[model samples]
Target: MTVNEPTNHQDLAEAPAATGEVADLLAMLAKQRHFLRFTTRDLTDEQAGLVPTASELCLGGLIKHVASVERGWAAFILEGPSSMPDFTKMTEADFARRADEFKMLPGETLAGVLAEYADVARRTDELVAKLPDLSVSHPLPKAPWFEAGAQWSARRVLMHIVAETAQHAGHADIIRESLDGAKSMG
Candidate 1:
């Protein structure tokens, strides 16, 4: 979609109706994705990788990170936490490799990242739509921030994904503005 395209809410109204909790979750996700898409629109690979802010976050990196996070969470919803990568035991080199997933590293392009983000979103929507129970719970992976024996419902997972995407979308907005004085939203 173009930067001047209608807002996500407006576009969603024209699409098929999404029912219940899935609808709500998808709406929020779509709004965040909208902003993320807007921020990256018309950007070159070089511009996407530019670190214009105090933070290490770049527009393209934010895109890639959000996509990867969403995909992982979706997998967790489908196949439990064991389906996720073990970040706790990652070596220094592993951490470095993971960090590259956020940056527009060699052979990475804005178009490629955006395409992957779209594919992940589509898969997530399909999974959520077909889920029989939003209340199905999965144990969270071992992490310093996670409480021991903690588990999250599928609904909760979807909410977390929405929150994560929205947070990064905001980061992308700031990075985009810093790069070229273009605002994702007023």
Candidate 2:
């Protein structure tokens, strides 16, 4: 099927019904998540971990990183920036641990990472639906990347999640093409 085809295999994984802006946001997120997930289709654990490009990102690593990012941002919606690590104060060890999120360390299976991603996605969808107000926001935590005194509503955070997922899905597409001939998009 072409990219324009509705209900392709990649998009078969979907959340329940939502409406209006919430529906629009969730739909975009699911599409990107599916594209990222699609890149790993039929890949072996070793293949998933192989970095075929100059970039360190492997298909499985991309999955792990995206899932970690989404989970943290989803928590931020409810718990605010405090739910995230203090990126400013992280030590070398902490930095190293964060980097490991991109690797399929020994015994880490493709199936396992994908399963974790699915769980995280489900929880994020549920959180968005149950939240009373998308306008509710929190001050961004101190970080080099985040602007000072900036606050983001739940809706804004969700948009960030969608952007992150799409960016990484593009990375995953490249990685997958390098690993094999498969393409998530034509």
Candidate 3:
């Protein structure tokens, strides 16, 4: 009924046993993801692929980059050795590789980007679901950009990702609307 209200009716039925903090976090994450999906829903391949006004960023690129970030951080907190793109030790070649990763290839379509987003998002969700202890401190060892030896609970990392994703999702929605006439999740 409202932004604060549960979208999942079944979840509401179980609310007596659920913590509001956990539910709110997860719900916000879902809202963000849903908005991203809505924004990209009707984009043509060319629209999704367009890098407008000399900017290197595109809707598809933003979605892919966010997915890569989500997987990277979640892996750091849960799976131990991270499989994410290493921005720290990234060489010129690595930046070049990322340049390619950000652009839509010859065969890439909006549908393809959506599929990739869903796949990455699902993996991120699974990583969060399987955490042994959300409150246990786990240093993001490879992220030197973070304070040296700084630690975060798995919950905090996940919440950060969700918040970051939501912010970018807003950007994607605006870009998509400008590119076409699509709008999405609040």
- Each candidate structure's TM-score, on Cα atoms with residue i matched to residue i, is 0.90, 0.93, 0.78
Model 1, residue 172: displacement in angstroms? 0.7
Clashes of 3: 0
The residue-level lDDT of candidate 2 at 51 comes to 92
Q: lDDT of all predictions, in order shown?
A: 0.81, 0.87, 0.66
Q: Give every collision pair in model 2.
A: none
Q: Which stretches of candidate 1 lie over 4 Å from their true place?
A: 1-3, 6-17
| Reference-based lDDT, residue 54, model 2 | 95
Predicted candidate 3 versus true structure: per-residue lDDT over 35-152, tens digit per residue? 6556565467787778763567788777777777777776777654354555578799878877876677788776666667667766666555555567866655555577766777
The clash count of every prediction, one per candidate, is 0, 0, 0
Please write out the lDDT profile of model 2 over residues 66-184, one tens digit for every residue.
99999999989999988999889999999998889888899999888888998899889988977778999999999999999999999999999999999999998899899888788
All candidates: CA RMSD (Å): 3.6, 2.7, 5.3
Worst 10 residues of 3 by lDDT: 8-17
Report model 1's TM-score to 2 decimal places.
0.90
What C-alpha lDDT, on a 0 to 100 scale, does residue 52 get in candidate 1? 91
Most lDDT-accurate candidate: 2
lDDT of 1 by residue, 1-186 (tens): 345742331222221356987788788888878877788767788998999988888888888999899999999998897898676897999889778877899888877887788788888888887888899999999888889899999999999998998888888888888888988767
Best by TM-score: 2
